[model samples]
Target: MSLLNNVFYFQNGIGVLANVFLLLFYIFIILCHRPKPMDLISCQLTFSHTVMLLTGGVVWVTDIFESLHVDNDIKCKTSFYINRVMRGLSICITCLLSMFQAVTISPSTSFLANFKLKLKKNIIYAFFYICSLNLSLYSYLIFYVGGLTNVSETNQMKVTKSCSLLPTNYIIRALNLTVTTSIDIFLVGVMLVTSAYIVLILFRHQRQHKHLHSLSHPRSSPEKKATQTILLLVTFFVVMYWVDFIISSTAVLLWMYNPVIQSVQKFVLNVYPTVTPLVQISSDNRIIKILKNIRSKYHQIL
Candidate 1:
């Protein structure tokens, strides 16, 4: 195999394996709890991550096959649409996670804090809204995307086997890329700010002198663990997303013409869905509980 094909095969293999374990691990966590607020949200995130992984895997495999001179038109289109859809859903759900966490941590007397109690029941509905909004926004724009057979040098669009977006009005393309990148930046920024604030608030409340200290009494509060997990999640999101965004944005700026960089950017963006499960598995309570229980029993027998 060519060096690029060999590299992608190994990388995508690792991602697929990691995501499989994550799906199982998160499902275990979901089942262990009595359907708590956070448990439900975590479940949704895991499910979305699985979809992301599957679509990403298909895209990766398709690339490898194309490299080997195998062309499958139906598979290519399916892979393209599925990848885009899952990516949109994943982004929407992550944003929802941030919003939900912010609401959960809001001061008890705040007007929006009332929704905390309703979160377990209402989060799925909120997710649906986010999905719908994404679908609507992407639907029109993706019309501009089609197979290579559809590409032409003429004023309109052309489609063939491989999905190639022909050059459009420079002003319009610039505006679209600018808007898309800006929205991504804004959403990621919101997630970072809210998660950071939650972490700080938790720290402050743990101080005995603060009025909020009583709210964080050790027995009833999962503040420390929850904050730690959310912070890790936000950090992973920022790092993985910026890798993808920066590459994509650079391509858009550099005349949108570099194939090799485009391939690498795609690889980087695809890695996160699989890697994300590892983050979740480490942060999950069920897995930790199982490990601790195993250790405790071992000690007793010893």
Candidate 2:
């Protein structure tokens, strides 16, 4: 195995392990506590991240095996499509979470206040519809993505293999790209705008209460801290999403001129899935309390 492959293998393995930890931790929290809207959304996000990591990890492992002349086109294509779907679902869930936070913190007299009240009542239904929509939209992958085919045989006994889109029609390709790009752009734009609004609200509140004691100001509110965390999460997701988008777009435009581009794109795609759980846990009070309890018990035992 090449050094680069080894590095990716290690990275993916770590991601898988981290996601597993997050999944278990989230499940435990949900089971032990009264589930709030944010907690439920977080659980869904963690589940999506776990699936993304597992599917992507499988593809990476398959790549390593392929380097050793082991070919499994079916497994690779299946994992690839599943990973793509999970990635999209993760993005949508993150966007939803940001929107929820935005609504939660909306001013009582603001226009969104009534919508926020309605949204709280139907949050579960909203989540169900979001998951169903993403699943249905990404179902196109099953039709277009296929197993690897032998492209060429080199004189050195090396065989080149690739799993490519089945549709050769330019219209199909264009339609696919257009739909995917539109969805990504719309959701990302919502996340950015909503997060910006939340930040502006907090900033204005802080400024307005600058003379007040910390306890009296909304600046010290838990809602403000949660909003800040969600904003940070959204910011990180946007950065990673655009980086992956740029790399993938460049690779497509260049048409496989640089193999390194593909590797970088894969790495970039995994970044959010790997890091999101850590970020969520860091901002989660329940997780913090659980950890503190464990620490206390450990100290007493010691």
Highest TM-score model number: 2
List RMSD in Å for every model shown.
5.1, 4.1
Provide the lDDT at 88 for model 1.
69
How does model 2 score by TM-score? 0.86
Question: Candidate 2: which stretches are off by over 4 Å?
Answer: 59-73, 153-162, 213-215
Write the residue-wise lDDT of candidate 1 on 1-302 in tens digits.
25654566566666667667666755675677555666666666666666665655455566676787755544545555666666766776676677777777777777758887787577778778866766665563455554565333533332222555545677877787786677677788888877877776667556743655454364234645665667777778789898887776666555454556655765777666666666666666766787799899999999
- The estimated TM-scores of all candidates read 0.75, 0.86
Candidate 2 lDDT, 1-302, residue by residue in tens: 25655666566777777778878876876798676788778878888888887766555566666687754656555666777878888899999899999888888888888887687778789878987887788787776666545433221111113555453455665677778889999999999899889989988888777766555866455677788889988999999999988876554433343445555666788888777777777777777888899999999999
Candidate 2, poorest ten consecutive residues by summed lDDT: 151-160
> In model 1, where is the ten-residue run with the lowest total lDDT?
152-161
TM-score of 1: 0.75
Candidate 1 — number of clashing residue pairs?
11
